[model samples]
Target: MKLRSYLYIAFTGTLIATTFSCTKLNEEFRGELEEADAGNIDPAALLINAYSSLNTPYQQEQRWVLQEISTDAAMAPTRGGDWDDNGMHRAIHLHTWNADNGYMNNTFVSLGTAIYNATNVLRFNPSNQQIAEARFIRALTMFDMLDLYGVVPIREGESLEDFRIAPEVLQPEAAIDYIVKELNEIITDLPNNGPTAAYVANKNAARTLLMKVYLNKGTFINRQSPTFAAEDMNQVITLANEITNSAKYTLSVAGKYFDNFAPDNDTKSTENIFTLFNKNGERGGNVDRTWNTVAHYNMRPGGWNGWCTLSDYYDKFAEGDERRGIYYDYAADTTSNRSKNFKRQNVGFFAGQQYNWTTNQPLMARNPSTAPLVFTREVTIRTSGATLETAGIRPVKYAFDYAVTGQRNNDWVVFRYADVLLMQAEAMLRGGTGTAAEALDLVNDIRVNRGVTLFTALTLDNLLDERARELYWEGWRRQDLIRFGKFLEAWQEKAADPDPKTLVYPIPSQQIAVNPNLVQNSGY
Candidate 1:
């Protein structure tokens, strides 16, 4: 296989020129390649491009916006005229979104592009390791497509000649089976968990994704009322135990829980199972958006002052829970170069009055110039008046990366060991091979590590709240809500949605226009 054979020149001219290492894999290719020069093409570069595709959907706006903003865990309120992008954010939170929603359309296209890129790697004669990695990437993207949209368009065969052919659509049931099969087949070829394994496709990464698939198999099959089969629960438990038994990961201590998301989290984190690799001057997504999305405009980094968690969700954590928030002086800390010039800012949730860390002066809200910048618990979808910019609690999941003016070094987490434990516990509680006492112990283990009180007893509701407290703003809230049967329930700015069709987003209209085989999901 040669580079020119697979490059979709007309459609991916920019991607080929900038992203792929094949310099001549663009419109300039005029069949001038010598047969001997074919050996010069690096298959690893193509694999890296496949891996790079994850940055857009996972780290940046499209998928993260759909996953987080549509749930009770976070919302992008229309603060006067600032974040009101023609009601895109409001439609998501209020469950009034349609197929025309730009976020939904972009997310669908981005995931499809990722899948196409990953599959393109197979057309070239790559090594076994590269083949396994590319297949894993394809499976992961396809899993997301199946979760968000009910159908997945699968390109058949490892032939670029079939690029124009309409892909075979896999419905929910078949999609789940296909993902499970792919992961199982490639798990052994992937690298073992080690220093750099978190950023690459590895055995534990495959195991963690498998655990997610099995635990949510019921939810993926039926979002309205999920049924956890005993066998599927056992699969979840087994996969979690395999990862735990590897001894490569453990929960970060109570004081260092935020380290998992720090700028140098690539080395500092002990709990990350898999993450998207990023560096200051590298080709990666804008992870700084995690903080810039919510921080006050007057803060050290001068954020956009958008999106926040609801008060109802904020009340889930106790006062002493370190996951709630903790003050950290980024300027004083002598750590990575990424934290240079950063003023003091809290790591977790931010509420009440904020201040300039260096000057020790109260920060003022932009709306009311004289009033202090005090974040309040009350917020509305269409915000106005004095509280326009001050309402809603802010969350800073990733530590501030103030050194670089461009892409930050914080590696965006895709799976963490804490989530592994929670999944195991939930599986046990939902009729897996463990007892209720064992499930409670698993939940308490994480609680104790996070400086929170242990529960004397555990229920599904308590487990859901615990997940919210621990995994808030991490982009799993919507899926968790649907799995636990609380997605349609009203909370804060949203009211109960009478239609269950809102559970799965509609297949993007653009997709249906391009691929006639695609049928739009029921509602929209």
Candidate 2:
């Protein structure tokens, strides 16, 4: 609930001096930025800045490209020279990346900066409440690091050098235990009103994190043959039950799930448990990168016309389900002059001919033979010359924000109540104490609301698909696939059976260069 950004400067001469003892202060400046007298800065702002760091890796398209593009849920085809960032996009799609990938390095840096900034906040001697929030943020980032890179650089105590100089790198299993312990310690201090105020970290947020951690513990500990231990699954059920018992959230109203991603979603939606508050024109407001990537250039706010989903994923949705919203047919409007914005509501996946707003004419594909801009189900890893502009179905999960000049006001929902319900259901389905009927009911709770038909039974495979249907583009695809053991399976554009090491991304080569303690992931 504390959203004010009171930027203040604080001097930590002791921190700076102590850190410089082992490592040169000018070498990397690992701890505090200031060495001499700097004004006392507000710890709240620092904490908020740590919160803002979520926009960098967690909320952005780069992480999405890495997670989804590497799996069957999505792909980023090399559209000629446009999206081909020196074959990096193709490399991820083809399951052939190494330690030196730029996105990999960038993700590590962003997450590391988040952890470091949170540590700086703690060094300011914040209130117990503030400290709890900072710890939650740090733990969440560390968990992400563990999930993506299999190792987390954990800096403890007041030693700022510990943040840089041979910091302890917790492997996946250790990282999970550390995160679980951190959340359990801070859960009580976190506000119980997260449902009412979705921006700030709350007890419910910590609970959700615990649920996720417990659910993925098997995979974290044993990547090759992840077995859901009974105790761990029970813990997941307990955490999920604690959240559901609170009665703070439920499925969004039918045909209005978009309200969660609407421009005013931060305050408007009750389903969001925790969110990254993104205000238009603010530093973190440009969170609509995914929306911009898929939208056409002819939009009212011109789109980048990049990033789309394969038809195989698109076809997962049942017919007439509101989740699979109507794709307007502009083929009827065939006028010549193409000067205005397109007049079509392409929400879920766009396939047919796209039209111009003013002229009502269908736009031609860039490729001569691939006119009519028809997106097909079949997509190849190499889409340089043969693939046309309409190669894949573009996704618009977050409703296009037409009001803002630069970015939408939709706060990125990091943890929502619907996700809690699904987690609880999954925990039950995996032989937890919760009933199978209850698990099926929870799945139906989300589905029936979205106009999706109620399932007679819930299986692990379809439950995974149901997760994809409900939570795609919001992140979690990679983790979900790994938990279900489907991550290494070959998909359309990616035919190579992924190596076990590919289960977790390689630690950035640049990181190993700077930190001797850090070890590169295997096969890189």
Candidate 3:
């Protein structure tokens, strides 16, 4: 996980050393910071740290698999790399987590830790504003757990020991209630949407997350829960309106699509409502591009191969889908242009390929990561560095900085306004209550803004396909598939993958080993 340094500076009147332990509490717990001292902690600083923590682990679990694999945006080669699980990538991306695959471990643990730490900040007597922000963060983490794992013991409290989540099967419906209640109480407390791309959980951000709570409401929280509840769907609509109505946030008019993922653009993401903070100097800052195909090329003089986009996924995009050109390029085109696109891998030289000793080859035979191909050509052919980067099917969205002294570091936007636009649309589709056309229109609005043709049709299949093209690698694909009813459909290449039992992934086997109370999902 990326380091979350949401640090709390000791304020003017923090508890005097050794004088603040409550006798009723255990002595061990008493010596640490007290509830009273929390009042002195800075809310802004605490919030920054909390946001920074979101990035670390995502580079692996989220950036690569959750978004890219699941979305039709990219895929792994069946023959060559570790990413061969792209079917499962689509499976996992498509939201079919069964008992057998081990997805929950990293998800639950990482989010749980964030909740733990964020809850710890709950110690400081926060401004009602801070209270609202802190509550939203903690609740968001649990919701993450709730979405993937299903019944998580909703842990709370300052320390891990003090945290609580029972082994009981927590239903999705119940989880939604918790999320709604928390956000409603805190939404008023969130700051007005601001211009900074870093940590800023204002009312709109809260609403956006809450809308997500509702958008995925059917499958996770309650199937009976209408996706377009005036109460629920409006949160998204209202919030999106708030941004558009108010000048607080603005979508880029020039529509430089790549800027959204560029390493340097991290802090200035106007559409990004919330993010994992990273910058040039910090250790993990700008660190994402390092693991992505965009970054490794910076360090490899031999031109480390970029993330290959899978043919299956690439096929999902219609020729009109401009994102295909923006996010991934055909290897043949790069050769024609006589250029080498500079994308990189996290585990460079000495990673997983049969390359000789060099400190910087991402594919150099690493044991843990087989380095899946983002596109197919990566496995079948090796391109000379001189070739135009358009050759292979890897992600070209994230920017690289050869100028950076070492590991190029920058924060990643976890949730953004564009996501809210899509979620609002999905809720409309499922419930048929809101403006489905408006929902669908917002997507094409993005495409139009990007100089791409607007999506003309708006069927469930069409929207899913559009989502795959527009938001493919953004990490919403898995849940998108299930909610749209495609999780059970037959796909030719997945190898007898028809069993719908694959929907809810198993809690990692390792987690069960540690806590016997944690039962495995069925069919593991």
**How would you encode candidate 3's per-residue C-alpha lDDT over 451-516 as one tens digit per residue?**
666777666777777677666556666667766666555442334345555555567765565444
Clashes of each: 0, 7, 64
Prediction 2 TM-score vs. true: 0.89
Q: Worst lDDT window (10 residues) for model 1? A: 1-10
Give a tens-digit lDDT track for model 2, residues 1-524: 22533343333332232211234552355434546333476778778777776676766555656777787777777776777888888788777888888889888777776776777778776899999999998988888888888888856664454434456778777788789899999987988774446777899999989899989888887887888887888998888878878888767887667677666666557788888776665545466676777766655345776777877888898887766664322221232221233436545666666665555667655447335656666666556554646677777766655555675666787898888888888989898887889999989988988887899999999899999999877788889998998888877777756468888899887778766778777787
Instruction: Please identify model 3 stretches exceeding 4 Å from their true place.
Output: 1-48, 60-64, 67-73, 76-103, 157-169, 222-235, 266-268, 283-286, 289-307, 318-322, 326-392, 407-409, 431-440, 490-493, 513-517
lDDT of 1 by residue, 3-118 (tens): 11122122253233221122334325313322336566566766777777788889847888888899888999998888988898999999999998898877887787678777
lDDT of each candidate versus the true structure = 0.80, 0.73, 0.52
Order of candidate numbers by TM-score, starting with the best:
1, 2, 3
Q: Which RMSD does model 3 reach against the true structure?
A: 8.5
Per-prediction TM-score, please?
0.91, 0.89, 0.72
Question: TM-score of predicted model 3?
Answer: 0.72
lDDT of 1: 0.80
Whose TM-score is greatest here?
1
Please, what's the RMSD in Å of model 2? 4.8
Kindly report which residue pairs in candidate 2 clash with one another. Answer: 8-41, 9-39, 9-40, 9-41, 10-40, 10-41, 335-361
